[model samples]
Target chain A: ETSAKVIDGKAVAKQIKDEIKIEVLKMKDAIGVVPGLAVILVGDRKDSATYVRNKKKACEAVGITSYEICLPEDSTEEDVLKHIADYNENPKVHGILIQLPLPRHMDEARILNAVSIDKDVDGFHPLNIGLLAKRDREPFFVSCTPKGCIELLHRYGITIKGKRAVIIGRSNIVGLPVSLLLQREDATITIVHSRTENPEEIVRQADIIVSAAGKANMVRGSWIKPGAVIIDVGINPIDDPESPRGYRLVGDVCYDEACKVASAITPVPGGVGPMTIAMLLSNTLDSAKRALKFE
Target chain B: ETSAKVIDGKAVAKQIKDEIKIEVLKMKDAIGVVPGLAVILVGDRKDSATYVRNKKKACEAVGITSYEICLPEDSTEEDVLKHIADYNENPKVHGILIQLPLPRHMDEARILNAVSIDKDVDGFHPLNIGLLAKRDREPFFVSCTPKGCIELLHRYGITIKGKRAVIIGRSNIVGLPVSLLLQREDATITIVHSRTENPEEIVRQADIIVSAAGKANMVRGSWIKPGAVIIDVGINPIDDPESPRGYRLVGDVCYDEACKVASAITPVPGGVGPMTIAMLLSNTLDSAKRALKFE
Candidate 1:
């Protein structure tokens, strides 16, 4: 058995946030422009509110001008689109992001598509997606979850090229695009989806594992190669009476089993989740500076 | 040793063109509109010219109207963009194609990006590429070579879903996009590129092999599985003193060896080559009819 290494995502996130803050300060001095971010939060879901608060805190910490648009739970798709159009044309709002899992009445795709590509900090624009798919081409805004996974590998000095990368799931948001990104970097990729009969055996052979299957404990310790790096993207809620929320956050991987086999692995709550909003803030600042012709 | 089934791409191509001709006649009689294609040949390269001429004659034989434009070898990028804009705006023109490998001074990306996504029958536009990458979204144009190979499989009544398919290459034009298309049909895909250490072993394990690496006869007969369907997309020219052209075409798979082992394999010149221009014609017709709102 290989000795396990813990991937310190909290420390890594702090380093990234500090770097963005420094750039943000330079942007303010040179271009007379501080990057501005607009976050649209719908309803009063406690977790969504927490995420929104974290984003606002990150923006403030980075010296970014932050605006929060809180809407009532009964908002319509038209309302969301109008706000998107408003942020789209507003001079001050260079980057716009709507907290995902919007109210049921809202058409998520329609609203997301409405955000102009130039200001789409989330990198969900069709143009950016195509750019990501292009061989040897990297988009300005790569989707944050995948970006964070790659960054976790990079920060830990794990080489992805020529490595066996096993991605669990094939959702456009995570599995598919991450595979594209990894392929561009010259990694040998194997995608295991629902139809796969031997996912554990497939995963156990990975030099690098990216789990976004959203299934709790799907990737067990037994499914990992000794000394593999694990980037878990799933944020599942499990019943835990000891927690005040009446549930606890769990990832797709069983952390205890993985910690014994993986060389480095991220914890569910502190790993990719925090990095997502941080990247949004980073991309927002990028869009702001770029929109102002500063970057 | 398994005997490889001959694919007979030449006969297949002839039959397809004949069928398209009959369909064209019926459409002409039923409706006053005839499919129109615009080909822009910017260089004096003999091979490019021959390809342009072949496309034109194919359209003529099928009773589709062909519009030809031959500019000098040193046409300005602006001049090319202007032509593309004109064709894009024209109501009567249904399809427009610019021959690739433009003059050294010209920007290929700029010119390719100029074609409207709606009229981009080649499916080379960023929007179309983006749409193609999405799991559920469909692009208007599928790239020619990949489309042709898939059509061959479809016509042969080959089921792709759940098959173990391996594509050896990762080019944007062929390998990468074709993998996406095949994945949509539910085939388990494994992409092996130049960095792959054991490509031969990998190919030997696949039920379906799409060889587009452009390395002549790279996939040896021993590497193919019995009853595997192979579509060879490479067209490499080797010196041949016996031929007047001084060169002969060869596919990525050694025909002598592949024919001995593979259940089915496409031939070099007559294989994927002819299907490309045919699909372009189909895309052009689609562009024209959609522009005219005929369907």
Candidate 2:
């Protein structure tokens, strides 16, 4: 029997960036404008900083301008709000992203909501989500991670229409939004979570499975049906003494075992992670085009 | 084999209304305030009128003040918008409901969005829907019909957590919202639609099933898993020569056959229909309490 093909999300993301770079060049030559993305990061958390820096690099590679605002950990919510208000009014800033996990004192929801819907490239705002849920309405943006999941499917030409797709988790950011997108594409969708009884049995029946439960190795080879396509979104740290960090990153699905049974599967670290940044840049480009009326 | 037990929605609604009456009486005694509901009905469609009238009677029975506005079918969208704006600013109007299926010439989304989120009892606004989707935030109100479906499940003390639920539609009104609600309650949720292949096979795996496809008898006994609880939200009129109206109401489920396989089920006319109005009153009561700073 042939083992499952590994879906190279890292390569797909690079291809997308290259495609976007060509468009950015054309737009620059035609209108002398480049897409602008503003990232507001609160505090000095290492992870958030690394994420922001990586986003900046991605933006630059695509020929888009990147703006960063680093706020003090003790900064008042109003201080963050003022910066968001400034970006919303700035015509140059086509996309605005507020790095998540703000300090406890800050109201993350209020700050995120303050960003203009047109400039909300992160797609966390309710208006965009609501529009995304509806069939007729068009959302200004879709959340990055979920958009990346769908993009991987499209890039690989994996058929979603009329398939039985199971989503593991119901978080607003990934599981919920992705389910909406999948259903819109004509896939029958099921969401299984911690409270779901017999999750393994339910999952074993899916033609396609997206695991975002944030649990490590929750889905094993035995839980997968032969020929099923798997998109593993969970990034969990498991104890690995041999590794310098004392822990290693893993996905919700057991990748080693899944590859033997599944038709195609995405690997942790190199898979969904890279796609998120690619989709962010993609959304920024769309926002710039929409604002400039050049699309 | 024992047949399924019928869930009496009319009785449950009366029970809820009686409970609301007690709360209203206590509020009136303590603060001299009563919940007020304002309904805007456009056109002379018999169904819309009947719905509006039923709401009025429900309000009266529960000791809530009722207000109605009827407009001609030819009324411009602005004419309705102005009324909604007036109600939004009125301190006494705790709940504003614009009867659905408005005249074809009017803008439904624009008119509904015009109402203040505080008084939007119908919960059609995207903001509320977005908030509902998020686990951390509470929506001001849930759409009535879906809310009613959950209420029936709760009233019957049927545990939703960890159960596999199959929803047989994805319409914005009933199927979608209820799926979210079920997920929040910790039930594994699956949504099957027109494009779903082998719908019956997928549905047979559910422990709890909600049918809102608007297709008469789409779910037969063979589609049900033994001991499954069914909530039928579809209301279709079919030719019945024996009936005086020439057409009789039936749900998406084949009632006769379902009773044999299901553990418990709700009847068509008296099941989901009565619960919608009941939940409307419940939401209006909650709005009044929130506005009055009473919980």
DockQ scores of the candidates: 0.61, 0.73
Q: Which lDDT tens digits does candidate 2 get at residues B1-56?
A: 77999988989998999999999999899999999999999999999999899899
What is the C-alpha local distance difference test score of each model? 0.83, 0.92
- Candidate 2 residue-wise lDDT at B32: 96
Q: Which residue runs of candidate 2 sit more than 4 Å off their true CA positions? A: A241-247
* Cα displacement (Å) at residue B195, model 1: 2.1
For residues B1-295, what per-residue lDDT tens digits would candidate 1 score against the true structure?
6577767667767777787777667667778778888888897999899988898898888888988888998889998998988988887677778888799998887888898888787787777787888776778788878888888888777888877788988888999878888887777777889997677877886788998999988888789888899999999988899999998999999888888877888889888888887777777766666766656
| Candidate 1: tens digits of C-alpha lDDT, residues A58-169 | 8898899888899999998888888888888888887888897898887776788898888878887767888888875557688877777788888889998888888888
Native-referenced Cα lDDT, model 2 = 0.92
TM-scores for all candidates: the values are 0.94, 0.97
**What lDDT is obtained when candidate 1 is compared to the true structure?**
0.83
Candidate 2, residue A260: Cα displacement in angstroms equals: 1.6
Q: What's the lDDT for residue B67 in model 2?
A: 92
Task: Provide the TM-score of chain A alone for each candidate, in the order shown.
Answer: 0.93, 0.98
